[model samples]
Target: MAAAQGVRGCLLRGPLRARLGRGCSSGAPVRQQQQQALVAAPAPAQELPSTRRKGFLTEHAAPFSAFLTDNFGRQHNYLRISLTEKCNLRCQYCMPEEGVQLTPKSELLTTQEIITLARLFVKEGVDKIRLTGGEPLIRPDVVDIVAQLYKLEGLQTIAVTTNGINLARLLPRLKEAGLDAINISLDTLVPAKFEFIVRRKGFHKVMEGINKAVELGYNPVKVNCVVMRGLNEDELLDFVALTKNQPLDVRFIEYMPFDGNKWNFKKMVSYKEMLDTVRQRWPDLEKLPCEASSTAKAYKVPDFQGQISFITSMSEHFCGSCNRLRITADGNLKVCLFGNSEVSLRDHLRSGASEDKLVQIIGEAVGRKKKQHAGMFNISQMKNRPMILIGG
Candidate 1:
């Protein structure tokens, strides 16, 4: 019976055995040899599992780490740090007659302190930083501050938002210090109207600063215009026309309610009305896309060198995409613009909080971020802290 089975196996292997390289006769011993050959053959190599491949360094790369807020969310990577709570102009929509209490000089963060905090923020994924102020240009050592901030690693851009009163004298020094851009607040183009709106008589100075900024190659020099109903709202087109000849970016911001300006809803100008007014005359105006965290919705007319931007903070809230974390001159971390709640980094730092502890505190503050600002006009709960105090 064994011999017959071997002969049957040899018949089956008649043509295939030569390729496998072995005995090729048709007999019982040959059949047994073929069976041994089959048993000795290695199984086809199985593929390396995906999990094992992922574990290999060549297949898996490190992920980019971001400054995560308390709610386990990542932000838009921008920080606006206010240099002071003082300003030379008294724009009715921004500050009151009896100016808001100035943050004590002792309490204010020193340049070194600010730079340290900025470096830490950059380490944790803050890519852009804008130095703001009641007027940042008022700070005595602004040039040094800008130069120092420029040295922070991972910091892609550094800018200053000023009233442009002192820009002409400091423009060269500021530009030399690595300031990437400037946003000058000039609400009115008319000399008399400018004084009425800002309560200061320096229209020519502001214009000169704007012109100098342009001449010095301050790309996209932004002119921030706050549109108040009875105020300079009439000059909307006049301001927009500036963009036709120059390479300026003129932005009109909606008036907001805060302690500084005593914001009233009646005086507010809706962004829609402003846009409609412009489109009425400049029928060829086109809306332009802005960056993710940009407060303004930009637009430009055909064949124009200048651009217009509308910041509808009051009429059109863009809170869902808010990526800004503000540090008041006093060093308090404010997560939201209208938020009354604050985390005192000054107190923590003075209390001997380690750098890691300060970072953790910032993370917690960001975690408690409100999804949207409770409209200052709608909510009866007044913060009493004006825009100047909050670093508008």
Candidate 2:
């Protein structure tokens, strides 16, 4: 029956429309049915088992403490650690306007545990780690977290993705802590619209933080902007123009669906659309070479001080070269950003799982990664945790 029904069986469809109320825009109704029908197909029989028992990892651990490689043979070295799932701002796309139930502090990973897990991954050939959160800086000890991750051996890069609310004040301490890169999330240039979208009144402060990051010599201070149709879509060229003078790698991400965002296809402005708009304005825009595992389809405007990137996770899926593994604040490992599948490392670590045992768990988790996220059109099936709970 499952095979007969195929991928559509995995979708969470019926309740979405009723839940969306009158909030969804014009094209949502068409997408609602079409997206649901595009759910993920069943896994192949030869694929890794869906088992999550404690002993599974201990038995099938890979040799020589190598880095994680999924069934598709993609090597994983980059790790995104969600320090905490708490934020000061309430962005429209990230969560409900009324806000989400915050996770209790006791359930989250402690600083020591985070370090231990990070050290294990580093030892297993993981070279880079990026700290993320509902807003990483919200945690009182975020600077300390950066300070500690910097001290780990074999970990080459220490980066953070912040909303820039608390960033301006913490710039000095963060720079001193050996932080390597900073990615700020700023969706709009209009102060009023910014406040309306983020549900906060600190647009100037975030801009100040971006300036401080650039001024302090944080090379290529990347600014991430999520472009939605009715919302900030008109600012596509405006965002691109930011690169004309300053050294900002402005990234435009297509709007994605989640549990509470009331996401509809009408909201997303595709990568091709965004690029064409920019190209029409600046015909000399040149494509930049991207690393194998990069999610963004990067490009640079000739003679411009900085570059512009497109994280086309929606329209153009980049899963073929994916090399990332995410650890939620509460210690669950998510191999893919769009899928709901996860394994809890916190349970094993706290249960006295040895380093070897932990490595086994990591390997098993990576083995279960999906080929790609349900593409943009089929994203209603991706009813995973909201972006806030999943980090960034």
Candidate 3:
């Protein structure tokens, strides 16, 4: 989980050009100033009155909105929209090696439908939207989608969670289109292992994408690594070493079960295990403050320019302050990532539901959200969509 987890920051140019400062450097300690501008934007902070989810949006959350707030008073401000389910690579963990039954193109949300839902969410008090996919860069009009979302008055940030295959050539266009943050999935630092994991020959391309993102001034470009035992776990330090000079937020994600990919407890690398692995190398690893809604437990090594974090979705869950809502590529609104229940926004839109009617449907779905998802073991056993379909 990266954008699939949550996103932070805003664009320095394009639609947000008037609001952000201009300057690019590869030497900044962290987010530097572009993010500061986003933080100072006119949108209200995401503060929730609830004291349950510790360190979450207390004073920093936006004003409560009936449509966005759940029964627990967790004000949801982040929305992740899956651009498409089609992926160029066949990652072993993302989809079954035999592959999944792809949805017909006609069933997927059209560009306009995505934009319409985006505008609706912005009006409903959702400030951050992350574009996800089997690989979002595969879509030809993704840049245009970001452009349209950026133009929304109250929308504060636009991010993409990509496999980084086509990112090298498209990042500039995406930035010009008002794209703010990016999360690239790279589970292995080794080229051969990359091919083995993704079942594709695009390691060089992914590496190129990472370098290009940094070169183009997307500070703290998030690198998502799904840590699996007996696989790429040995390269944890190699991934962490990436943050020594670059402004990359290297996030280690715990592998969770879905409909396929054969997820099991043995493959999971817990948060504590990952933290201990990194701390063994850098005894000075320091814990960084994180938002209550944040799924990743952020940390940074002493004097390191970038930081390292862990998404403890398995070993430990952060559902208490959960503020994220996901829309599948086909436009089904999933309130919880692990929850199988969904309401079809695409179906409603296609059925000619009014804006107010759609809002009511979305609010009803949000209202039914549980205080938390099932435990890790139960989640693995329960039926859920594959990570690829869920847009993680």
How do the residues 1-392 of candidate 3 rate in per-residue lDDT, one tens digit apiece? 11111211221111222334323322121333443333322222233343432223222332334555565666676899999999999988889888888899999999999999988887766667899988888998998898888788666678888999899999899888877788999999999999899998999999999999999988888999999999999999999999999999999999988887898899898889988988899999999876556778889998888999899898888887787899999999999999999999999999999987887788778867887888988998888888899997
Q: Taking the tens digit of each residue's C-alpha lDDT, what string does model 2 give over 284-346?
A: 899997555677888998999998999988887888877789999999999988888899999
In model 3, how large is the Cα lDDT of residue 373? Answer: 87
TM-score preference between candidates 1 and 2, better one: 2
Q: After superposing candidate 1, which stretches have Cα over 4 Å from the reference? A: 1-67, 70-76, 379-381
Model 3 misplaced stretches (Cα beyond 4 Å): 1-62
Task: Assess candidate 1 and give its lDDT.
Answer: 0.71
Tally clashes: model 3: 10
Identify the runs in model 2 with alpha carbons over 4 angstroms from their true place: 1-67
Candidate 1 at 109: error in angstroms?
0.8
Rank candidates by TM-score, best first.
3, 2, 1
Model 2 TM-score relative to the real fold: 0.83
TM-score for all predictions?
0.82, 0.83, 0.86
Candidate 1 has a TM-score of: 0.82
Per-residue lDDT over 200-312 for candidate 1, one digit per residue giving the tens place of the 0 to 100 score: 88899998899989888766789988888887899999988898888888989988787656667888889999999999999989988654445789899989998898998
The CA lDDT of each predicted structure is 0.71, 0.76, 0.79
